[model samples]
Every structure is written in C-alpha cells, then in structure tokens.
Target chain A: MKVTESDDVISFAGGLPNPISFPIEALKASANHAITENGSRLFQYSSTQGYAPLREYIAAKYQRVHGLDIHADDVFITTGSQQALELLGKVLIDKGDGIVIEEPGYLGAIQAFTLSEPTFYGVTLENDGLNLEELEHALQQPNVKFVYTVPNFQNPTGLTYSKEKRQQICEIMAKYDDVALIEDDPYGELRFQGEPLPYIGAGKLENSILLGSFSKTVTPGMRLGFIITKNKELMQHIETAKQATDLHTNIFSQYVIYDYLANNDYMEHVQKIIALYKNQADAMLNAMEEFFPAHVDYTRPEGGMFIWATMNNGASAVDVFHKAMDQNVAFVPGDPFYTSKTGVNTMRLNYTNATPEVIREGIKRLGSIL
Target chain B: MKVTESDDVISFAGGLPNPISFPIEALKASANHAITENGSRLFQYSSTQGYAPLREYIAAKYQRVHGLDIHADDVFITTGSQQALELLGKVLIDKGDGIVIEEPGYLGAIQAFTLSEPTFYGVTLENDGLNLEELEHALQQPNVKFVYTVPNFQNPTGLTYSKEKRQQICEIMAKYDDVALIEDDPYGELRFQGEPLPYIGAGKLENSILLGSFSKTVTPGMRLGFIITKNKELMQHIETAKQATDLHTNIFSQYVIYDYLANNDYMEHVQKIIALYKNQADAMLNAMEEFFPAHVDYTRPEGGMFIWATMNNGASAVDVFHKAMDQNVAFVPGDPFYTSKTGVNTMRLNYTNATPEVIREGIKRLGSIL
Candidate 1:
C-alpha cells in the first residue's frame, strides 16, 4: 500500500521550522502596534532599500554579534534570502559564468542560479566545511563569479564549519580577488549547543556577501530576509536588481517585524525554538540508532532542521522512500540537493517540523523499511 | 534655495495610491482574525503558487467581472504586479530577445524588462491605443516574445484604449501565433467616470496574460498582485521562474488580504476609493486647466494616478522640473518613462498622493515656471 500525502503519514519532508516556536502573541501585538503607530506609512510603498528602522536594527544586531564594523546602509532587506540568491545571480552571472557550490547544496540556491545560465562547479562538502583544495581548484577556474555556502548548520546536511576550517577557507579564497564568497547563515541562531562559528569570509574579504533570514528564528510566512555587505558598488548593483525584481520587499511585513523585534526579547524567542528543535533532533538520532540496520549511516546534528542519512549497503534513497511511504512515513530524497545529482543513496530528514514522539515514530518506520 | 527633499514641497511626483483609501481598520481586523483562525499555518512557508483560497477568489472575481471562464489554477499571486513583470521577463526573454512595450511606458515595467537584456521595440502609444500599423510591424519582427500594455489608464500617460482599438490590436496580434499579449491592468478598477474597458487579448487570445494588483485599490504596502492566464504551459514556466525568484510571496499578507476580502464588502471599499480618486483626479485636471500655459498640453485623465503633460514649446521637462523645485513644487520628468529616453518635453504628474489644494498650488507654481 502506497501512502502519498496522507494526514496519517508521519512526514519529515518539509524544510520548515516548528510552528509551535513562532511568537504568535508577540507578532499579533506587533501587527496592531505597527498599524497604530505608523498608520498610512505602513500601507504605503516604501523605499527599494527596505524599511529604514528594520535595516538599522539588522545592522546593529550583526555588529553586536559578530563585532564587525557594519553600517545600516550595508544591510539590504529582501523578500527572503531566496530572493537575495536570485538578485545575486542577476548581478553577477552572465551566460556560462562559473558559480561554485557545495556538492550537496541547498537546492534553492541551485534553482535560483540556474536561471542565469551559470556553469556550476560543485566542491565537495566535508564533515567540517568545504574541501579547501577542491574549493581552491574551483575558484581558480575562469570567470568564477561566486562561491555559495550555508556554512552554519547547513540545510539538508545540518553541518557547521569548524572555526579552523572557516579561517583556512577564507585564506585560500583571499588569493581570488574578483571572486565573491556568499555566506548564507539562515540557521546560525538555532544552535542547540556549542559556540556560534564566525562567518569565514565576511569581515576579511572585500567581496564577502552574508545572507541572514528571520524564517528560522522568527517566521517564514512573512518572508523577511536580508543581505549584508560593506561593498557599496556591489550593493548598489543588487539594489538596482531588487528594484527591478519586485520594487521592494513587502513594507507592511517589514514594519510589523521591526516592531516585533523592538517590543519583544527576540533572543528569548529564538532560545525556545532551539530547545524545541534540539528535542526533535535527539529523538530522530536516537530512533535511528536503535532501529536502523548496521550498514546505514546518519549525521548526529547539533542544530538546524535536517539530519542527513546515507545508505551504505548500496540501497537507493528513492526506493527506500517509496517503501517508507508504504509504512506511512516520508522524507525527502537527497538527489535534488545535489547539483550533479549523484546523492542516490542519501535522504534528508527534517526534524524541526515534527514533535519528538512523532519524529521517533517516523524514523522507526523508515528504519524498518531500510 | 532649491527644494530637494523637504516636507513643505507640494509634490505631484509619487505614483502612490491615496492612503486615505486604504481600508486600514478592516485590514487590522482581518489580520487579527487571520492569525486567530489560522494560527501557525499562517506563519509557515506556504505553496509557491500562493494561498489557494486567495487565488480562487481572484479567479472568481475576474470570471464575474469579465464574463470569462477562469479557473483558480489560472491565477498566480505575486509579491506585486511588478514581480509579474519580472517573472514574465525571466520566462520569455533571452539575451537580445525581442520585447514590445509602449513608447512612453511604465518605468517599473521598463526597469523589470531591462534586466532580461531584451531588444525592446517601443510602439507608439496613440491617444486611444497603440498605432495598429506600428504594432503589426513590430510583431512581425523575429523572436518577438510578447507585447506588454497597460490598456486601462496606462501609467505615466493616463490614457485608456478605445473599444475599437482594443479589438483591432487583438486582431493584428492574432497574426503572430507565437507572440504573447500581456495586458497589465493595475488601474482598471479605478475608473472614476468611464465604462470599464474589456481586455484586448485576455480570453480572446490563447497566449493572453493579464496582470492585476491590489496596490491601487487595497494597499501597496502588502504588495499583493497576481497574473491570470489560460495558458497552462506558459504559467508553469512562470511558476518555475517565480520559485527561483522568491520561494513565494508573503503568505501572512496573502491570508490577511484574503480574510479582509472574505469578511468585508470589498467592492464597497473599492467604490469609496474610486470616489476619492475621482475627486483627486478632477482636482488635478481642474488645476491644470486653470493654471497651465497654452503651449503646455496635458492629458485630462478620467481616472488612475498620473496626468501626462507635454510641452509643445520645446522646453525640457527636466529644466521645468528644476525651476518648479525652486518654487517648492515637483513632478516626474518623463525622460525615464521612455525606452529611448526621448520624452524630454513630457512630464508625469501624480495627483493621488497629494490633496486637491496642494495639487492646485503645485500646478500654479509649475504654471508660473512654464
């Protein structure tokens, strides 16, 4: 019996944050306050650069956290970090321009860059970070415009770059003056344990572009994300692209989000989400340990939404996925995550969207299938 | 002293809707209700196609209004109609691909299409519509992907197509089997006096793509706009482009907007807006008639945001703008509106943002400069 998109299925397919962690009450209050305080301004078309107060707040927060000399003008808000990817492609990529990505990368970035008709070079993503030798080789290629990475708690793999590796990678890329390092850190704040890793290239490299989003920490539905860079000329080009794309990000959402940040303890709210995800990750990891066959391997993620499982016994993930669906369980096959489409025996399990018990049940079913 | 960015300037330079017309209280109520009813679902990442209910409502409304058969799947919501333009460009345009646009077009559309690096063919927009012969000639050119038009009260020009011209243009366009017709009607609902015109190509042509927006009637800040089309293959390609551009439009805004429409009398609210714009439109035209020099010819717009003024005396609008700025008055010099940048003697004056008295005063100051 094949179960497809049933309510009874314990699914780990969605790359969504736990909705239970969303600050609903605070957001509701913020929405009302934003409307009341700003009035018509909240409903009016704002600048292409984004809402002023929100941009300033983002700049200040980054400065405080990273101890970087970041300015408000450097923080450019987007519809989501997804849009930042699209806009970056518009700015940087011409037909057949070289773009470097991790072997198994965030598919969203892959999809966004594909529209620009770039030749993608996939550098292998090791346990700590990118394989530096491979990255340098890719960077050495002609017209290599940028290297995209989700360094901290990366999507699908749930991997973070080690501090030493981060430093080493930045040094390796420092030779490539024209190349940009895009450090997309959507899951940086959701660290369940360990010290937060510094971005590899941001402060050191002139062409470093950092992306952050409120999707994981605050809410995804509002679609508020931003790009931070000190490169004025690059930012100006991006601003022009952004204007052409959608005029600007939604102004009302910007005001409401800024208001929510102003009124609430944002870190406190993020802490609650971290706690929830930590529990779910533990449950899934423990379930895999208890039930999976000896040949199967999976990452024990410290933070972030996904735990990547690799079938070591020459079993295809797509086949396993079909069998798992028969047992009322689901997960994303890992093929889509690969630019080269060679992750045939791997699957990505999202731990954030499900409760601990439900995650355990889903993993048990998948383990039985395997 | 020149007025550069002072609050005292009585400006007719903004292409913004009257904030007085924004259903603020209803929106606030709907926002609250949408949150309370939907809970976490409203805050989660939604479908790439957009919220299903809102799409359905839009399709139903178009079907009712236009007497056309439109399914819910035909309507795809965007961040703004601006995004629709961008997405259309992304799907249709390759480097040096032929694209047809108005001679004096909406700057936003021009900006959006420019990113795709298309070879723009600007057909002359006559008093009623595009010159049929010019349009036919342009469409005959190789690889002409689409002809874009704002048929009802066009941006920068404030001119609507005559009924006969609408049909004639469609008939001429019918000769080109591969070319699409994009009928952008952001201001169709804002008709203060004249009868609402039928879309030239929509429902009549297989490749007709209609763009609409809530920005003019509802609120621009929410950034809600949509593309309606009967062409499944074209829409699917656009959906792919849209997914790459931004994962989705703000889902919270979509739910809030849908809820607002569901709970409130949307047409009644629109009627109030129409009435308000009518007053503002009349005020600006009356002021223009009373104050403008004989050599300055301007469109007496029946509806929509702008009044296009042309200087028959060969004085640059930019020069006039500079002089008007010294008098603490402003309007957009129309050079940016043209693809070839030849609207030197034309200016676009927006009446919607300013009050009637301010409009009168600004026009009087502009008249003195003339």
Candidate 2:
C-alpha cells in the first residue's frame, strides 16, 4: 500500500517497471522448478555473498556487458541495490564524514547515507554528465567517503553520461586515493537510442564500486541486486556489514532469479524492456513538449523511467504536486532529491508506468493548471 | 554456504528450523497462487510498513499468542529479525554508546550492534533468567542505549525466562528512562512442553521493543520477520532506518506468507513443527543424559533448538570444538557468544538439526572424547 495504493490516482511517481513487464510465466515455472529440484536448499539459509551460481552469472554478465573483469568473490548479492547503499554507508561513512552525491540525486541514496550521519556535498549535473570541477572540489574535502553517481540513465533525471565524461570522472576519482567511487547503474540496460557507454568501472578504477539491479529490466518484487568491486578489503567489510544487517538476502529469491536467468535469454528479455520503455519515454517526452508550460523545461531521456522537469521563474514543484493530486494526477516533488535548498521548482515525472494516452492526458491537465 | 554447506559435516551450529519442517508443498502452491493472482501487485514495490493484511495478521497473531494489544500500524515487517537488530543498532547505538547484553548472548545480535560501536555490558544469566542485580547494575551504566535479550528459549543457551523474571526485567528496564528494552522472541512459538509465559512487552514496559520471526515456523528462505512496539517515535525511526536499508522485504515472500496464513491453519502447521522438534530435542537430551561425562553439565531445555553445555575444571570448548569438527560433528564455539572474557568451558549443541539415531551417535562420540 505504497506507491501503487490508489487506483484513481494516475501516479507517475514510481521508480520501478510496469507490472506487465514481469516474466510471470517464467517465474511461475521457475518457482515450480526450484521447489521440485532444490526446495530443501532453496528454502534454507544461504551465505552473505549470495547463491554461488547467481554471483558467478552476475560476474560473467559484467564481463559481457561492461567489459569489466570481476570475480564472483568480488560480488555480493543484496536484498536490493538500496541495501547496497545502506551497507556502503555503514562500512564507509562516519559521523561528520563528507560524502559526494549528484545534485538532484536519487532520494533513496540520500535516505540511506543520512542514517550514518554523513555530511553531503552534491555536485551539479550538466546535461551530458556530472560537473567535474564541483566533483573534484567535493572529492578533495577532508574525510570524504565516496562519490555516489547513477552514471547510466540516472533515476528521476534519466540522464546518461557521455563516454568522455565517464572516463574523466573515473580519472578524477582515481586521483583521490581516500574516496571510493560508487557508479550505480540500475538503468544501464534500458538504453534505447545511443550505443551503450562504458561503465566507470571499466576504467579499471580500483575504488570504483558498481551497483546493478534487476528492478527495471525484471521484477522489483524479488528485490534482488548486487554490489561489485575489485577491492577485497572493502568487499569483506560490506559482506560483514550485510551479514550484520540481514544475515543474507532471501535465499529463495536468489534461487528463483537464478533459475529464470539460467533458463531464459536474459539479454533478450532486457531488450524487450528497452523497447517498451523507449516507447513510453518517447510518448511522455512528446506530450511534455506539446503540452507543458513554456517556462517548464524537461530532459529528453533516451531511457529509464523518469523525466526531470524544472519550472523556471521559481514555480514550486511541491505546490504543483499538491494541485496535481487534487486533479488525480501525481508526480514526485523534487525537493527530497536535493540535499541543499535547490530543486524547489523541479519535479520527477515517471513515464514507465503510464501509457501514451494517459501520459498525454496527465500532461494536458498539468499544462492547464500551470 | 553457512551451516549446511557440507553434507559430511553434521553441524549443530545453525539456529534455523530444520529444512524438512518447511511447508514446501504449501509454499509451492502459494507461490503459484500468488504469481497467478497477485503477480502484478506482489512483484511491484510495496510499503515500508509492509503488506497491510500481513501486518494486520501479525498484530492479530500477537493478540492470540501473547495476549498483547497491538495495532497493525505498530508493526513493521523486516527481512528477518536480523534486520530488526541492524535497524535498532542504527537508530539507537552510536560510537562509544553503552549497551547491555546477556553474557553468552546471541552472536548475531552482537555482530549487529558492534557495527554501531557500542560499549557492551554483558550481565551474567542464571538458569531461570538473568541475574537481576547484575542487570540492574548494567542498566545504571551511563549512556546505556538499550538492553538486548532473547527471553524465550534463547539461542545457544535455550534458556527461557520465568514469567515473574520477565515482569521484573520489564519493570527494571522501565525505570531506566535513558534506555529501551528489546525482547527478541524468534523461538517463542516453539515451546512444546513449557508453560506459556507472558512476554516482556506484556509487562507494559513503555520502552519495550519486541521482535518476532516467521523463519522458524514457516521457512528461513523467505526471511520474514517483524518488529512490534507501542512507542510510535521509536517505530518511526525504525521505519526510516528500514526504508534506508532494503526499502522493504521481498514482496512475493510477503504475499505467499499472507496467502498461506489466510488459507491454511498456520497454528496447526506450527503444532506439527512443535511435535517434530520436541521429539528431536528429547532424543538429543536423552542421549546427552546417557552419554555425557559427569563434569560436562548441560541445560535440560523444555524447548528451543539448543542446549547449553559447560565442561567443568576449565576444559576449553575451543579445543573440544576443533576435536568435534575433526570427528565430523560441528557446533558453534562459545567464545563468540560472550561479550566478556567468560564461558571458557562452554559450548552450545543444537538438537533441531539431527535425528535421534544421529544424536545418539554424536553424543556417544563426544562422550568418548571427553
């Protein structure tokens, strides 16, 4: 009873995939298969590092997808990528320690790291990538823990960094020996138009910690994700942190996901997601271009669930949010995404959940209200 | 790859339910039913408070089982009771904070809170319950965050507090306005022969935080657990901490558990488990009575998975543990369970994981070694 609680509300605030994209048939089959074949083990306690085959598969996928050499030992399966952030916060952040994040960042990351009592420095984001100058300055801050970024089709904003910026950011992070770099890429496989850019992890930055999730391409219900890094010391700390947190992620989930991945062409399945989200994203963008107020500008995202819209002349998104709720149309207000007193006039509109017609209707209502 | 990693290793180290006790058939049916009927919602992201019906059910169960008046709003579903400990640590413990624990306490709880850098004060536990004077002294310590205890057939020791002791402990904790009380009852429902003692929360301790788990009754694979509290402020902090941790537990697991609970007589199933474990525990106790050396004292537990065994005259359990492992019989060493330098001659043996024949052979071997 959270984001999907109301049926009357045309909600575009969710950061997950449409339920129709869920591989229900395959999952059902996998459930039966796992229960029949590995019920005793699947339904029992598992290691903190996760199911061996699944971890190996994830490691292999990284090699294939990002051209990054990673071992199974370097990966630990989490309940979700959010848990990874929380574990990283536990392992890395100290009270009053500085943590670098993107301005208008993922709110979940903000919530996760804040629990550890870290001081945050949010680097401004250009259309193409992060502001390198601000990132450098933030990295140079005393006791800076890590630079957190969603480098591929970032949440809320749905912006992917250029290849040049990706490499440059990696270099900038590498120059700072103390700070680790978290390259969160939940939407990496959702790209529609451009060639897939190299992950910052591919730059071979030893401190580059890459996080990936199946929430967008697969089902969020499973809540499966992974944290991969070459740093064994950091990984060991994270593993201990994870064990301290949940013992381990649900073993049944790891088994089900593994069964599904092994029995199906996961890449082909992700391709279908890319196609569907590409259409939905295009529809939302097209409607926004046609119906949005002249002063309101939004990103033209190639992939991911959301479009970041900023209303010029200081029009508050929270005000619009309240008004839109009355109209039975909802979008997430952007203030929570900002660590500072910024993004007051910005909002995140998710395009992945609603159809083209619904997107158009919602945009029309908002335009008239504005 | 934890306790059950090797088939050759007859490990009594695990604190989970036997896999054979898992309702695999019912779970498979529930899985299929959930996928077919509620896949869209089940697989989608849900609330941090948990699935509404499940929370209501948990609150109802507490009323039925422990005679506690609780609301659905007072319950937050955790990944396992382990995550509850982790969240508690994050909310309550800070670097150098004082926390009271039982001597030879739950190792998992120690691991969870140690991440928060708390200075632990372990009070010695007697047969019936904790030594009240020591507990009172520990509670009076400056900066004490909370007192953590598993009062119902506790892990490793398998010691359940008497109802009067539970009440007194609650009153003692209530007097300490600076600290809270965590009553972890993962094995409360497993009592086959003992009288149903009132929970510490039933004493109306204002600061009491109760944790319960479904892992033992249903299956550990799902990793479903809950944190119940009447204190809304503390509950809010735990919810925020949980949201930062894993967003929420696996949704499908919640749906399946809910479905199973609603459709079946969950109590009857648990009763079946009670019978099975009671037999196993009795067999192990009988074997120990017949085969154990005179100086090797052990608790005659009426319930729970473990029996507290202490070898007299300073016999090192660490040495016994290594020898036991060499003989292909494994148990958790007692050192990790203690917060202080004590319990040197102690070890814990689990009865839930072995059959009567196996228990007999294992005890015979251990007796010969002693």
Candidate 3:
C-alpha cells in the first residue's frame, strides 16, 4: 500500500519536478548575491504586492515573449499557484457560487476552490480542449463567477487546447461580462513539441486572468507563483486577501529568484529542463505504445509532467493500483481529479519526477497489470 | 498624508522589526550551508507539515523552555503566523460563528478573521490582561469557535498578561468545550525586563493552540511561522487547509533557518534582539513621558514593539494624524485595530523601526499637536 516508501519502487505518483532540473549552484550564487547586495532590507518586511524587481521581471518576460500589454502592476506575487487558487477563492467565490472547471480537473484547484464551498460546474474535456457545448452550458449558468482552464499541458491529462478551441472560448466568454476567465498556465513554458499556442483569454478577453508558476521550470520549494490580470478591481481584492493570508510570499525567495533570473540566462536554464522532461515524456509514451494492452488507452503528452490513462476494457483502476503496488510501482488513481464521482477506470502517471529508465520500467509494470 | 514617503519624516507607524537586529552575515552563511549540504532537495517540493528538523527544533525549544510536552508531530509550519490566522479561520470558523478577540485586537488577525465573516466578540483589555468578566461573556456565546489572544507583548498594545490573569483565562476557557483557545506568542521570547510568564492554555487546556513566528526574532522576509497544538483533530484540519493554501511554507527558507539554528547560538541572537528592542522601547517611552500632555494617557511597555496611546481629552486621532503629517511625522491611527467602529481617540506608536533621536523628535511633534 505504501510502495512509495520502498527504495526499489518506481513511483510515478508525485507531481514534483525532477530535482536535477533545479539550477542549484546558480541559485546558491543568486542567494548570496541577493543577500550581499540588498543587505538587511532583503530580510525586512516588504510590500504586500511583492518585490518590485521580481514583479518587473515577470512583467517584462510576458511582454517580450507574448507581446502582451502586461505591466508590473498587473502582476501580484503569491506563495504558489496553489495559493493563487485559494486567494481567487477568497476574493471571488461565495458559497454556492458557480465555478466552471474542466471535468477531471486539477486536484489542487479543486481542493483550493472547495474551501469556499462553491458549486462546481465541470465541463467535459475533449482530446484537443474542453468540449465547446459543455463549456457554453457551464458559462450560461447564472451564478458562474469564472471559467477556469489550464490551456497548455494541463495537469493529470497533459492535454493542450487547439488554437481554434482557444479562439472560440475567448469569443464565447467575451459575451459574459459578469464572468472572469482564469487561464492557469503552469506548464505553458514547458512545451517541448509542436508550435506554442497563444493564450485563450489573456489579451483578448476583458476579464481574463492568468496564473503562472516558477515551480515546474525553476523551483517548487521556494513556493513562488503569481497572478496576472488587467482587472484592477479584482486585483485590489486579491491584494487585500494576499496581505491577510501571508502578508506576501517569501521575500527572501523573491529576491534570490530575481537575482537568479537577472544574472543568468533564464530561457537557457528552462531549455535544459525542457530537454530533460522531453526525454522522460517520450520514454513513457513509447513504453505505453509497445507494452500496454489495446484496451488500455493513454495520452501521449507533448510537455508537462503527467499522462492520463483510461481503461476502456472496464478494468477498475483501484484494483490495478493494488496490483501495481504489489509489483513496487505506483501512480495516482484518477477518481480524485473529477469534481464528480467519476474517473474510476482512469489513472494519472507522472513522468517528470522520475528518470526515463524508471518511467519506462514503471509503465511496463502497469501495462502488464492492465 | 504621504509623510511616510518623505525622508525627513519620523514614522512611528510601521510594525517592522529593526533591521539592525537581523543576523544577516550568520543567515547568509546558513543559506549557503543549507543549499550546499542538502543539494537540490532544498529546491524541490517538501512535506505539507514542514522541514522536519525545523519543526523538531521548535518543539524541543518549547519543551526545554516552557516545560510543555510538545513533540515534532505537534508543530505545523506555515507561510507566516499571518497564514496561521487564515488557516485557523478556514478550519474553525463559519460565517456567523462567534469569535472572541481583544478590544484593540491585532489588526492582522482582524483582517484574516474578517475573510470568514465571523461574528467577533471583543473582550475588553485591562491593565493586566483581558477583562475576565467580558471574556466569560464572549465564551458563553452559543456559536463561539475560538478565543484569539496575544498573551505576551501583544501587537499595537505591547501588554503582557499577568500570571494570575493567565490562570483565570485557562480556568474560564476550560468550561467551553467547543471554543478553541489561540494564544499567539510571537514576542514571548523577546522579554527584556520582566520575568517571563507561563502560557495560559498551552499545557492546561485540551484545545489550546499556540502560534509562534520567526518573523519577529529572525526574519519577516522569509515568512516562516508555525502552529503548535496538542489537538490532533484541529491540527489535521489546519494541515489540510495549509496544503490547499500554499502546498507548504518556503522549504529553502525553512532549511536555511533550521541550518542557522543548528549552527548558531539562537537564544544568544534572540537576546541581542531583545536588548535592541528594549532600548528602543525605553527611548520612545521616555520621550513620550517628557513631551506628552497630561491629558494624554499612554502605556509604559516593558517589552515588544508598540505603545498604545489614548487621548483622554477626547481629541480625534485622525485630526492629530493630519497635523502630525504637517510636521513630517507618522503614527498609526487606532480605528482599524477594533473589530467594531470605535477607538477614534487612540493611536498605536511603533518604536522598533526608528532610532531613539528620531522617536524623540516624532513624539515631540505629536505632543505639540496633542
């Protein structure tokens, strides 16, 4: 049952980025530089909005890469993207307020939103994106506060929205003035295959909100993430909420990370991580294609950490999980991903935390069980 | 109104710990040591509870200092003590639930609790501690969830509860099974003049919770704080809430702080901070004594960051705030400290962020206005 504890276990259960992907020596130097340069001000209480230089860097990155009109004021730092979910819950959601989420959604989002006790309207996810009809239906609900989407390399499923679907979503959401669009893009920068797609609502939609995280690409242990939006009213409320939650995210981490980004080539560092994860994703996909039974269907992810698999032969994933544990292999059963009680026949496999060889071995074991 | 931004302004408004008190060099060494020793694990995702050694150190400190029966399992790390308040609100509070607070409460607590939309019952603070009668009245409410107190050197007030009052509070709270007792003790270790008093409910009551922070003694920029409780049920709920909030506190900061504590003389460092704060407090108090009008009453604090001043002649603090600004001085108006709309004649002066000469100048200017 606790195969994760065993030294020989090949676990794909974690959502962790590989530690090898972290630029440790560079970060250590950055930490030292930030401490030496900033002096005691780095250790003192700072503005609730966050460190100005870090926010400026984030704004500059988005402006340069996306050609979006994002400014430093548009970005607000958070403890993590997980906290962005919680703060949004605090700021926007009321009890029984309608929240539109992808069916078999990100569990962390679900967990954060659940604290507000919102009425979840989960739309079905298609191969390319969310089901358009279901998205429209969920949006049409009178109390719907926001439509939450992970447009690129989505968690658990590791699926990206098609360009056509992204445009349609923007067009449809533009009609609803009361509703906000939350496009979470933690894995957007990790795209290793195919052309990068533009965000669905970031610039096009008036009420669009974007969530970004350094957890996957840089470091998760620092727990630095941010919310970017042009909506001043909503941002103001979140600032207040952020102040109450933790005053601000860790300023020491903020300074250290800002120094790291400033001194080193950030994109070059990210490219190394992209290459590493690309190899892992390829190994897992190839292993599944070779060894998995025909009745067991799985996603071939382009980027990000996870692969979603469904047993079309009606094999219960819970039973398979037990058998896999017996063989010293582990993965997450996908039931917890859904807002509703579904995904019983599905499971989520993570490729980023393990090596290519370990991922292949783990998938081979799972394929035998299937 | 913007005197705070001016260089010549003597600001007594900030609740920041003095930068001079921070052990920057020692902490820099600790940061380097932690990153070098732990490798990339320090940058990866960690336990929701916290870094184990840090929690263990915290637990052992309480066991050794207070003779409280605490273990590593009893301590849960948070982003900051501010987040502890937020987590408590999430776990223990419901809309319309009864919350007992001080009359001039910690504004951060007020902000955090306000998110849950709880019905706050403010028990008046006497010279020694909370008014026993008012506390009893609040706890007797049917929906009372918790009683929040800053028992040692409270924020804005800088008052410590007497040993007798502590005993009485424990006795009174022991009757309320449903109400949890939250004794936030951030400044407990910073006692410079008085004999340290025992905690009211940490060892005496079943549902007692103690909130501690490194923000005051070590560094606020790192945003590390924790909750220590023997109540497993409440702790489990807080753990879930913490995981949903930010995954965990910054592990890099946690590891570095733990490393610092392990390698350095922590209590010796704390003593230095205590001594620095004591001198600042004495300087402000002495200035106030010499300059303030006879009609104005203010507390002579033995320890902690602030001194509460009340206009006995019924002068409006807001009006005084404007005049003080005209003279390029700043102090916090006390209206926000109350849960209710009161405290118009009171103001909170902070001593830790300014020099003695500056504090004297500020008090002189404020006194002329008074």
Task: Identify the candidate with maximal DockQ.
Answer: 3
Per-residue C-alpha lDDT of model 3 across residues B1-370, encoded as one tens digit per residue: 2458678888988888999989999999999998889999899988999999999999999999999999999999999899999999989998999999998889999999999999999998877999999988888887999999999888878888999999998999889866889999888888888799899999989999999999999999999999999999988998889989888989999999999899999889999998888888899889989999999888877788889999989788888888899998898898988888754999999999888888888898888989
How close to the true structure is residue A348 of candidate 2, measured as C-alpha lDDT? 87
Comparing 1 with 3 on TM-score, the higher-scoring candidate is 3
Which pairs of residues collide in candidate 1? none
Model 3: how far residue B63 lies from native, Å: 0.6
Give the per-residue lDDT of model 2 (tens digit) for B1-370: 2543478877777776888889889988988887778768878888887999999999998888678888899899999999889889988987899999988899999999998899999998788788999999987778999988888888879998888888888788778866888999988888888688887754387788899888898988888999998888998998888888889889989999898888888889988989999998888888888988888888877677899898986779888877887787877778899987754889888888888888888887777776
| Per-chain TM-score, chain A, candidate 3 | 0.98
TM-score for chain A of every candidate model?
0.98, 0.97, 0.98
Ranking by lDDT: 3, 1, 2
Candidate DockQ values, in order, are 0.91, 0.83, 0.93
Q: Compared with the real two-chain complex, what DockQ does model 2 have?
A: 0.83
Q: Name the best candidate (by TM-score).
A: 3
lDDT of 2 by residue, A9-32 (tens): 877887768777888899888888
Q: Name the candidate, 2 or 3, with the larger TM-score value.
A: 3
Displacement of the residue A3 alpha carbon in candidate 1, Å: 7.7
For candidate 1, lDDT tens digit of each residue in A87-177?
Answer: 9999999999999999789999999999999999999898999998899889888899999999988887998889999999899889897
